[model samples]
Target: MAGMCCGFVGEGDSSANSRPSRRRNLDMLPFKYIADMTVAPSGTSRKRRQADLSGKKDFESCEGSNGDRGNEKSKKNKNESSKVSENKPSTEGNLEDGEFPKFGVTSVCGRRRDMEDSVSVQTSFYEELFHFFGVFDGHGCSHVATMCKERLHEILKEQINESQENFEWNSTMQQGFARMDDEVQRWNSSSQTVTCRCELQTPHCDAVGSTAVVAVVTPDKIIVSNCGDSRAVLCRNGVAIPLSFDHKPDRPDELIRVEAAGGRVIYWDGPRVLGVLAMSRAIGDNYLKPYVISEPEVTVTERRVEDECLILASDGLWDVVSNETACGVVRMCLKAHMMTSPAESPANNEVTTDGSDQACSDASILLTKLALARHSSDNVSVVVIDLRKDQRPTSNSNYNLIN
Candidate 1:
């Protein structure tokens, strides 16, 4: 089986479940995100704003864009109002929503021999102005991550709709993840959706698993749910805020839970659950059972005026770049292009589209390039959403590049 463009799996290699651990000294975010490692930044769609950051040159400057920090302060002072409606994002698969989702994304199979990551984006998802974004990193095979890209959002939405209270994000997120894990098992038990290397072999394809980080953006709030190592970050007023924490096996709380469940954290390169998976939680990995569960940690934050953008990625980019550095780069891009591309107006009701804003596109491109520049050895995926409303910063950012 060939490795995919977004997710990579060697032709016959099945060791991805035990992907090597890169850090034991992760830097901390304001939300206490354990950064001793790089989580692959994930959100969806390859067709929109795709660019190869592997090249040595810096990105071509956007129209009216300038470099240098001095101009940012003066430029940021001017804000605008618009009548355009919120638009739907591009799809990670073969999806077409007619135009840009107003978010920017980028993913690449850098240094890694194959690709196995998946991203998904849907705007105005549950109601008017509510949106969904997610990134998945598959281990053991591409199917698990791909499966997540195809259905996790629907599962989450289903849970939300089925709820009696409807908007209790925390409980609904937990149930959504539980249902997703069940679906993976049920689907794997009977058939192999893709011509995956796993060949649907173990019971319910128990050998496979995936790391997921998902976010729901509403007119007034940002709700994030995470399982495994993928991450979601909020760039608020120049500070990098982590919405979800990583579930590395070595993390104190995670290690304690694993031990209580009678599972061992083995040091295979770094730390692994029973010397198998490096993360203590994920959507699948049924063989790990009680130890490696599908329950996601959820965080909800109110939207603020100073919010710059939201970043969601897999460990691939985080492994090599720090949270502050990533935020700094994106902020620079947005500021440089402030005059040429002002933020989108918050008044649009229905959706319309074309492509991502230039600054966001530039930011996503530069981040991936920076990751490769730092020699990241895995798939790199990123999604940047301009949350600055009434003063939109190019409106959005989205790009994807894979093997």
Candidate 2:
């Protein structure tokens, strides 16, 4: 797949200094929306002091033609708006309509410096037998995460276009990942300095990079591709089936790569890889590029009828919740609901659903909350995919894709 043309990196400024201004904009949008729905109080009103002190008065002027009744309605609206803003969508991409069974998905930012660094994508294509879900975790900075969020699907689409043959799944997935890495490198080279905002500039470009774990589900199988410590776990008949393995510095090849790149994997007192980062492979960390690059270890496996669910999460979630515990939560979510497709079943299992279909959304949100409760120090992100829909057969027979 061809990478998108790199954009120019604007003037240099510290992103840290500008973060508060950006967050303030995010905070004010909800406040304005609330105010537009309420009525304004008179200047001599007794509640003016209380309202000003609480900052709730900002929304009171939103009340319209209904007068005092509108004011009361606006009060309810303010409360509801507060609740909605507190509960943002778990995934990053826009939701798709009527593509799959709707599932409630929610996301709550954990106690971290940033609001969120996790992203997810769902798309319906090939008439609903294929589904794509990806979770990217930005560690040092969010550049890598943002790049993946924008380009992953485009890369896949390019690969599919280049390969006219049917279902060369493994090659397609590998090529897609390689293309993603190549794109990142290209991005790095094009910029004078790595920065997220076009208007901001910073001297330190070494700290930006992220971990990626992606899952592509077809009717007959599921393919998982991973880099860094982010993980993917599949639940079959309520049992945990680990699909991706963490790439740590301890692995002989990883150590070799690090050393080859003129970076040393220091073995201090412990056997820990490189004496610092536990993971051997990852997508970003320009400083570590000499020691180890972000080449992903890929795995492809056939799907079973009993396969119930899959969980893709960053280390933040895994650090707090065990693999078994995460699987249990997703399993419970599946059992609580019945699977219903938004469209008619294909004669063959060739159709797929988009990530924003809302089929597995709620479970994704709950998983994020669970990680937060565990007091995870880093940014937390999770993507849950339900495979029960694939287990059920329609008039068409299922076919596995292999190459």
Candidate 3:
């Protein structure tokens, strides 16, 4: 028998760069003992084997040696199942990753009464640039804030989708606030009321309400909706652009609503719309429901590229810091510069060292510190959106967060 031989010589070989001409060579043998062979350079042997055996596998040996193979296959399957179970997303994952069941929120009760405040961020299309941040500050009880936290986004989406015309910014905002209030009342009416026996405690079932400030960021515009004392502000080029006005009971329009609702705006020390309530338009406070149903005065402004950031915070933050000071603090936080935490006591001029300047950092923590520093007596909550980095306009059709 004649054996086929293959070899390769490196460096000075002429065949290194040349393509070998195809030819057939054979070793003659008896028909019953016929065999076929092909020769290739040592470097090409592994490649040729890979190309020829792309799909075929050695099942015959495994079938014959079924004893060990069964145990091995069972172990592999069990390992894979465990891996899948391990990979299941946790509750915290849902919040942080913005998955189907969205997540990523942080709240502290602070040194106050029941933390009746709630905040959340929702991104439906997974476009990092499209985001919604909200702050709900509840009074009397936490129902209004809890409800808003759960359903505000759904209500807004429903209103937007039902409208045939392109959403006029103001009208859309008005409807969103109205819808939110309606939903909150509907929920309260359906549940069994709880009553507080203590005189100092707010009537548990009687009138619990909250102020809502929602900031919706789209590809072309940023829409802000507000009711009651809660406020939303956009920091543009280091200036505060007030997105919503505080609806004080003293305001002429608010006073008109208060009186019309059979509630007199009594001013003993100052203007009192509905006795002690400072704001005429707010969600919940069943006593104020009649006046609350009135549409919130809506204000819409086209967003400019220079609008660097937005802060949707409760009165707790505003009561301590002026709009100008708030803007300055946010700007410094965005630039990685130092700012005193709101938690520090201003009376003593004490400074806290936990303030963060990272763009992707949560603003609530810093806002809490600021509130503490300003000595805000009320519970403080803040929702900060870094517009420049969080919701940037994109040329691509897909949504993505700005880096």
Among all candidates shown, the one with the greatest lDDT: 1
Q: Write the per-residue lDDT of candidate 3 for residues 78-108, one digit (tens) a residue.
A: 2332332222211121111221111112244
Predicted candidate 1, C-alpha RMSD: 12.6
What are the per-residue Cα lDDT tens digits for candidate 2 across 314-401? 7767777888888887766544333333253221223222213233554666676676555454555666666554333233343221
Task: Order the candidate numbers by TM-score, best to worst.
Answer: 1, 2, 3
Candidate lDDT scores, in order, read 0.62, 0.51, 0.49
- Of 1 and 2, which scores higher on TM-score? 1
Task: Please rank every candidate by lDDT, starting with the best.
Answer: 1, 2, 3
Model 3 ranges with Cα > 4 A deviation: 1-107, 125-129, 191-204, 260-262, 268-271, 337-357, 360-363, 389-403
**TM-score on alpha carbons, each prediction:** 0.70, 0.61, 0.60
Stretches of candidate 1 above 4 Å error?
Answer: 1-101, 192-194, 199-204, 341-353, 390-403
RMSD (CA, angstroms), candidate 3: 31.7
Model 3: lDDT of residue 331: 63
Write one digit per residue (lDDT tens) for candidate 1, span 1-403. 1122112123222333443522211112011111011112355322222221211222222111111000111111112111222222111112111222346666665544345667676654553245678888877776888788778778876775566433467888888888889998888777545476663366457778889999987655788999988889999988999999989889999999999999999876567788767788987777888999999999988776677788888887887888888888888776655534323521132122333355665687788778767756566777777676423334445421110
The CA-based lDDT of model 1 is what? 0.62
TM-score winner between 2 and 3, please give it: 2
Of candidates 3 and 1, the better by lDDT: 1
